[model samples]
Target: MYQDEIIQRVNNAAEIENSNEMLIIRKIEESEKPMELMLNENDRISDIKIRKLVDCIVGRKIIAEKVLLIRDHFVSLHDYLDLLNSGCLFDDEYDALFATFGNFEISCIL
Candidate 1:
């Protein structure tokens, strides 16, 4: 299934879990300014995934748990691709990009 489909499933499930999910969305929206500043500071890339994930989580496009899971497993190439595939990033060609920067380690951020 596509990422959008997966996101819809997650939203539906979250709604089932809490009937007032919209309220949570509204609360999150109210804090958007500071959140954007924090994201800009924390995000190390010009990549859209970081921004999209921020949007998705704030809008509850996907669940917090799923986002956290993706963030946790970002060290793996496969997991990284999965995140990119999920509309979090704009990699038209994953293989080429991976080939070019595969050896770089996230820990070696210097």
Candidate 2:
């Protein structure tokens, strides 16, 4: 799926010498497994298809910004994924990342 494409790109970006590329790579690496786990169809809520819903809610820019944040931070991908799953989309450093992609209206109202 698209996450696989993102993983491949992350692996590739990790090999580069540039700082930005490395940052991107780190983000992808951190996110890969957690994102995969969250996307598991069996694990998703009955009313929500996690992956599809996320794709729709986040859009491309937010997704990109999140990856960038993941790249810069040393946290595991699951942590962020959990936060997203739990509806803490604007918590802690995630808020910074969200801000970077411009102000977005989270589809799920708090």
Candidate 3:
């Protein structure tokens, strides 16, 4: 799954950087509003996978520490997925552009 792949890549990068912390992704059925809370009062919440939760605590820490490489990687992955879901992958122009970076293959069984 794309989510698992993203989590693995982020965790691998974190491990290489000697950061033992890892983020967790959760799915909520229904909620009035998305919120982020620490698992415990003493423990810091690295990332919260709630919808529409702006002002991520961990994201701020990453930026504040100036870890540009990891940040860029995550941003790029997010943008690529967004574009792909928006049907940009089917467009010849975008397909060629993405191909220049790497081969992106999508196979479907219909």
Candidate 4:
């Protein structure tokens, strides 16, 4: 069921004209499980899959630009991920993060 949900999200994201948005949605889908578990103090966002996704986004200039624009503040992708993984963000901060990653529309599902 979870896999199906992810696939649906991927398809929806693919409908967007912006390839970066599509990629961001796919990353969010990839990291959804870890992100949910990350709310627990015992779980960490340093999980390999999440890290690799972050790295991929950071490595791509165009995607990184889109991410930075969504951030609305200058910060490297590594820093953004670190802040997110730290689990200390306020509601608005988390919202901004989701918006930056093109996941705002489906954030409730996340």
Select the stronger candidate by lDDT from 1 and 3.
1
Write candidate 1's Cα lDDT for 7-43 as tens digits: 7877888867865544232233442332111112233
TM-score of 3: 0.22
lDDT per residue for candidate 4 within 1-110, as digits (tens), equals: 47678887787777764575433333445544333211223344455645565555445455435345434432344445464564444455455446544333234224
Error of 4 at 2 (Å): 43
Considering TM-score, where higher is better, how would the candidates rank from best to worst? Answer: 4, 3, 1, 2
Between candidates 2 and 4, which one is better according to lDDT? 4
Could you report the Cα RMSD, in angstroms, for every candidate shown?
18.6, 16.6, 19.9, 16.4
> Candidate 1: misplaced stretches above 4 Å?
1-70, 89-103, 106-110
TM-scores for all predictions: 0.21, 0.19, 0.22, 0.23
Runs off by more than 4 Å, candidate 2: 1-62, 88-110
Best of the candidates, lDDT: 4
Flag the better candidate by lDDT, 3 or 4.
4
**Which runs of model 3 end up more than 4 angstroms from their true locations?**
20-22, 31-110
**Clashing residue pairs, candidate 4?**
none
Model 2, residue 69: distance off in Å is: 1.0
lDDT of 3 by residue, 11-34 (tens): 788868976576777664553333
